[model samples]
Target: MKVVTTEIPATSAPPTLGVLLAGGLARRMGGGDKPMRSIGGRTILERVIARLSPQCSGLILNANGDPARFAAFGLQVVADDVPGFPGPLAGILAALDWTATNRPEIEWVLSAAGDCPFLPRDLVARLHEARARENAQLAVAASGDQSHPVIGLWRVDLREELRHALVVEDLRKIDRWTARYPLATVMWPTEPLDPFFNANTVEDIAEAERLAALDDAS
Candidate 1:
């Protein structure tokens, strides 16, 4: 892959939409919406919304359900267009298609895991900067040595290609599909707490509580 590095002007970032990926089965968390779990006396989804709302033109929830359960959040809820629970890629595609049809002016969409309550405040800006610096077609967040593929910025124009990859080609892994494009990675420090730390089980929730206490202290 060719990597072109350039400085992204402050005004160059495109109008972007935020998509919270909450389509997981959460089997390890006892089979409920993990985003709905409470931490620091608030639903994880609420923290996610609070963190992402200011970074995008608008926000939507990409989940598979009645949408009523999430009605309290008051954001538009979208479900995967491809059936059979294809995974995060499918949710990303759903957000892309939704943005294409409903918000044509939006050229970029940021996807973040709903279960991650402490997503970095500068997530969108940094992703945009990295993509601009690398002239990359896609950007994903990384910390330590691990890349969080689901937390990414995608061009709205690639919706059809992604749809084909998911529906026709049966591609499910986020990293596998991302490898075909010019990918820019933006790394965040993992001290104090990993911004992308997600709750996956009962114990994880307890850990989140401890982290929440730390977050409050800071």
Candidate 2:
């Protein structure tokens, strides 16, 4: 299927449902919910909500296993339709499928890694702007030289294509898939701690404590 896009709305950004990608089996963080780990006296998931909730019309958690694990977050948890935990693309596809079925009026899905506590407030606005400016098929976040594909804007219309990539082609690398279309990478500053900082291991959690202090001071 062709990956096409319509003109972005010039008015306020369209209603977008934010999907927090938390379907990972975090073996690096001892195989549990990394976002549930605390930082700055708050769970990382709480900080993610504080940072991302305002930018979108609604939020959902994309996770596998028991939906009850994220019951406290009070989100509509949607697991991947495809089996075998096919990486972040599966989570993205789940969100896209949910948007298509439940919110046909909403044309966009803003996806972010559940572990990133310091996501930028301007994420939705900036991604919309960059995608429109570049006339790109998608917009992803970047800090310094790194690209955070999991944290990005997805067109709901492209759900079928994404599903094909994940299921038929078994594509796992985000870059390899995104390379097929025009993509805009919105760059963020690393100073004062990168807004895309993610905690994956015990040591990273300690570093997050330090960054949490810097995040509060900023």
Task: Point to the candidate with the largest lDDT.
Answer: 1
lDDT for position 124 in model 1: 89
Model 1 steric clash pairs: none
Q: What CA RMSD would candidate 1 show? A: 6.9
Off by over 4 Å in 2: 1-11
lDDT of 2 by residue, 1-218 (tens): 11112223323676778999998889997799888899999899888877777788788889888888777777789999899988998999999999899888899999999999999988999998999989998999999999999999999999899888888999998888888889999999998789999999999999999999999888
All candidates: TM-score: 0.94, 0.93
What's the lDDT for residue 98 in model 1?
A: 95
lDDT score, candidate 1: 0.90
List residue ranges in candidate 1 displaced over 4 A: 1-12
Write model 1 residue lDDT over 63-172, tens digit each, in one string.
99789888778888999999999999999999999999999988999999999999998898899999998999999999989999999999999999999999899999
Q: Cα lDDT of model 2 overall?
A: 0.87
